[model samples]
Target: MYDRFLVSKQIDQWLAEDIGGGDLTAQLMIDPRATATFAMNAREPMTLAGVEVAGLVFTRYEPACRIEIHAHDGATVERGALLMTVSGPAQALLTAERTALNVVQRLSGIATETAKYVRAIAGTKARLLDTRKTTPGLRMLEKHAASCGGALNHRLGLDSGVMLKDNHIAVCGSIMEAVKRARLRVPALTKIEVECDRLDQVEEALAAGADVIMLDNMSLETMRQAVALVDGRALLEASGGIRLDTIAAVAATGVDYISTSRPFQSAPAVDIGLDEA
Candidate 1:
C-alpha cells in the first residue's frame, strides 16, 4: 500500500519528468486564466485501480482543481463508465492529463490482468500471488494493484525473505547448505524458501526445514508427486510456466499458492480517456 505522502512524491517526480521546463502545447495554445472541465471514461471493461492516485497526479499539478471521482479503486467497470471528472485552469488540466491517465491506465491494466488469473484459480486451495517482476520504480503501486484484484502479495524484495534459488544452491553446494546459511543470517522469525525444480531437490529442501518450497517449472505429475512427498511439511508455491491457459490446472496440482509475473510484466494498459466534459 502507498501513503499519500509517498504517492505525492512519486507523482511529483513523474510530473517533473513529463513537464520539464513547461508544457509547450498548453503554454502556447491555452490562456492561463481560462478554465475547462474533462471527464475520464473507461473505453473497455477493467478492474480499476488507482483512481485516487490519478486524482493525486492532477491535484499535484494544480492544487485548486476540483475532482469528482465517479468510480473508486477496485471497481469492476464496463466500457463507457465515467471514472472521474476534473475542472480547473485549462492549461493546468491539459498539462496534467497524460500523467494522470498513464498512472490509472497502467494500474487498472495490472489489476484487470490479476483478476483474470485470480478467477482462473478459484474454487481451489491455491491462492494467487504477485511476484517481484514489477515496473522498477512502481513496485508498491503495482503490488497494490495486484492486491486490488485479489492476489496475495509475495515477498516485496529479497530482504522480505530468504529464497534460495538455483544460483544460491549452486553457490552453497546444496539446498541444505544454502538454507542453513540463510537461517543463520536472517532474522529468527524470517521464513526461508527454497526453489526446487526437481523432486530430489524438493526432498532436500524439506529436509533442510525450508518454510516454503517453490516448485519451479515442474510438470503437473511431478508437482503432485512433490505435494505428496512434502505431505504438508512446508507450504508449496507453484512458479514458472504459469499462464492463464494453464493456471487452473496448476492450481489443481494442490500447491498452496501460484506465483506469476505476467499480470505486471505483460498486462496491456486499459483504454481510458480524459476528454472535455
Candidate 2:
C-alpha cells in the first residue's frame, strides 16, 4: 500500500505539469458548473495496476468528486471491462482525465508484462525479481506493478542493498576484497551480493561469504554449473538478457531467483480509455 499523502503530492505535481495555467480546451467547450459521469474501461485485456492512483488523480483534482472503483489493482480483466467511474464537475473530470488514464495505462502495462514472465517460470523454484531499471520518478510505483504481476522486487534503490558489480570488483582488486570491504562498511544484516560472470568468480564470491551471487549473462550450462558449484552456499540470482522466451530455461537452471528489467523497461502501455458514462 502507498501513503496517500505522499502520492497526493506526486499527483499534484503531475496535474500541475499537465494542466499548466489552465485547461484551455475544457474551459472553452465545457460548462464550469456542469456535472458529468465518466467510466474508465480497458480497451484490451490486461493485468490492471494503478487503479488506486487513477482514483487519487481524480480526487486530487476535485476532492468532492465521487469515485466508484469496479476493479482493484492487480485484477486481470478482459476487453471492455469497467475499472472505475467518477462523477464530478465536467471541467474537473475533463481536465484530469488524461493524467489519470496515463497512470493506469503505464502501470498496467508493467503488470501485464511481468505476468508473462511469471507464468513462464511457474512450477520452478526460481522466483521472479524486478530490477531497478525503471522510469526515474516511477521506480516505486513500477515495482509495485511488477509485484501485482507476481514478481518480487529486488532493490528499490542503491541504498536498499549492496550489489557489487564487475566494476566494483575491479576497484576492490577482487571479489573477495570487495565483499570484505562491503562487510566492513555495511550493517551485519545487510546482504552483500556479488555479480559473477564465470564459475571461478562464483566460487570466489561464495568463498568470500557473499549472501547472494548473481550469474550475469551466463549460458544455461554455465548457470547449471554455478548452481552446482554454489550447492546452497549462497542464493543464486540469474540475471542479464532474461526474457519471456528464455526465463523458463533460466529458472530451470536451479537458481533461487531470476532478475530482469524487460517487464518494466520495455513494456508497451496497455490500452485504456475514459468514456462518458
Candidate 3:
C-alpha cells in the first residue's frame, strides 16, 4: 500500500475534480443522513489495481464508510466478479464513485497490457521490460502495475541509468568517444549502455568497455550476429519496432532484455463500474 496521506491527497484531488463545489444530483435526490450499500463489480475481465487507492476515496468522502475488498491488486478477475463492497452515506457513495472507478480502471489497464507482454516471452532468457514512456504524474502507479503483471521496470528516469542514444552519439562524435567520456565521468557503480544502429557501432561500443549494448532497429540476422559478436562481454538488449507479433522472434535473438513503450502508452482503459447495492 502507498502512504495513507498521499493516497488521501490524490483522492481529494479526484473528488474535487469530480464534484466542483457540489454534487447536485446526490444532494437533491438523497437525504443528508441517508446511507446505502454497494458492490463494485468488473464489467469485463481485467487485472485488478488501485484497490487501496479507491478505498481511500470513499473513506475520505465519508469517514464512516466501510469498505471490504474481495479482489486484491495484481489479481486477475472475470467479468461481473465482485471486487469490493462499500457502505456509507448515499451522497458520499455517489461522490466517490467515478473517482474510484477511474483509478482502478486505468491502473488495471496498464497491468493487463503488461501481462500480455510478460506472457509473450515466457520460458525465454529475455525479460519483458518497460521504457520511460509512462503517463505523466502516474509513472509510479503505472510502474507498480507493470511489476504486478510480472514485467521488470527499466530505468524509472534519466538519472537512474546512462543510455547513450543516437543523438548523444552524434553530439559526442562516435560511440567509442561517448562511451569513453561517459565512463570517465560516471561513477564506477553506474552501468553504461550504448545504443548502436549498425554493426560498426556495435563493435565500437564493445571495444569502449560498454557494460550493455542496445541493438536498435536491427534485422534478426544482424541482431543474432551482434549478439554473437558481443559474446559474453556485455549484456545485449533489443529495442525499436517491437510488437506482440514480432516479440517472440526478437527474444529468440538471445538478447538479455527487450524494451517497448507500447504497453503503457497504448493500453486501453479497463472496463469497471461502480453501483449502489
Candidate 4:
C-alpha cells in the first residue's frame, strides 16, 4: 500500500506543473458553479492499476469532487467495463481529467506488460522480477503496478541492494574485489549480487561468497552449465534480453530469478476514455 500523504504530495506537484496559472479553457466554457459527472470505461481488456490514485488526483483538485471506483488495481477488466465516476464542479473535473487518465492508463499498461511476463514463466522455479528501469518520479508507483501483476521487484534503487554490474567489475579490478569491498560496508542483511558475463566470472563470483549471481545474457547451454557449476552455492539470476518469447526457456534454466526491463520500457497504455455520465 502507498502512503496517502506521499501520494497526495505527488499529485499536488503534478497538478502544479499542469495547471500553472489557471485552466483558461475550462474557465472559458464551464461555470465554476456548474456540476458535471463523468464515467471512465475501458476501451480494451487490461489489468487495472492506479484507479484509486487517479481518484485521489481528482480529490486533490476539488475536495468536493465525488469519485466512485468500481475496479481496483490488478483486476482484469474487459472492454466497456466501467472503472469509476467523478462528479463535481465541471471546471475542476475537466481540469483534472487528463492527469488522472494519464496516471491510470500508464500504470495499467505496466501492469498488463508485467502480467504477460509473469504468465510466461508460470510453473517454473524462476520468478519474474522487474528492474529499476522506471519513470523518473514514478518508480515506486510502477513497481507497485508490477507487483499487482505478479512480478517481483528487484532493487527499488541503488540503496536497496548491492548489484555489482560489469562497470563495477571493470573499475574494481575483478568481481571478487567488488564483492569484497561491497561486503565490507553493506549492512549485514543486505544482499550482494555480482553480474557475471561468463562461466569463469560465475565461478569467481560464487567462490567469492556472493549472495546472488546474475548470469547476464547467457545462452541456454551456458546457463545450464552455470547452474551445474554453481551447484546451488548461490541464488542464480538470469537477466538480459529476457522476453515473453524467451522467458519460459530462461525460467527453465533453473535460475531463481528472471529480470527484465522490457515491461517498463515500452508498455503501451491501455485504452480508456471518460464520457459524460
Q: Which candidate's lDDT is highest?
A: 1
lDDT (tens digit, per residue) of candidate 4 on 6-99:
8899999999989999999999989888999999999999998899999999999999999999999989999999999999999999999999
- For each candidate in the order shown, give its overall lDDT on alpha carbons: 0.94, 0.94, 0.87, 0.92
* TM-score between model 4 and native: 0.96
Structural similarity to truth (TM-score) of each candidate: 0.96, 0.98, 0.92, 0.96
Best-to-worst ranking by TM-score: 2, 1, 4, 3
lDDT of 4 at 229: 93
Q: Write the residue-wise lDDT of candidate 3 on 1-277 in tens digits.
A: 3456766776777789989989999999989899899999999998877876788889988899999999999899999999999998888898788888898888888888888887898989999888888888677777778877778888888889899999998999988889888988898799999998899999999999999999999999999999899988999989999998899999998999999988888888899888767
lDDT of 4: 0.92
* Separate clash counts for every candidate: 0, 0, 1, 0
Model 4 alpha-carbon drift over 4 Å, by segment: none
What is candidate 2's lDDT per residue for 188-267, written digit by digit as tens?
78899999999999999999999999999999999999999989989999999997998999999899999999998899
**Which prediction has the highest TM-score against the true structure?**
2
Report the backbone clash tally of model 4.
0
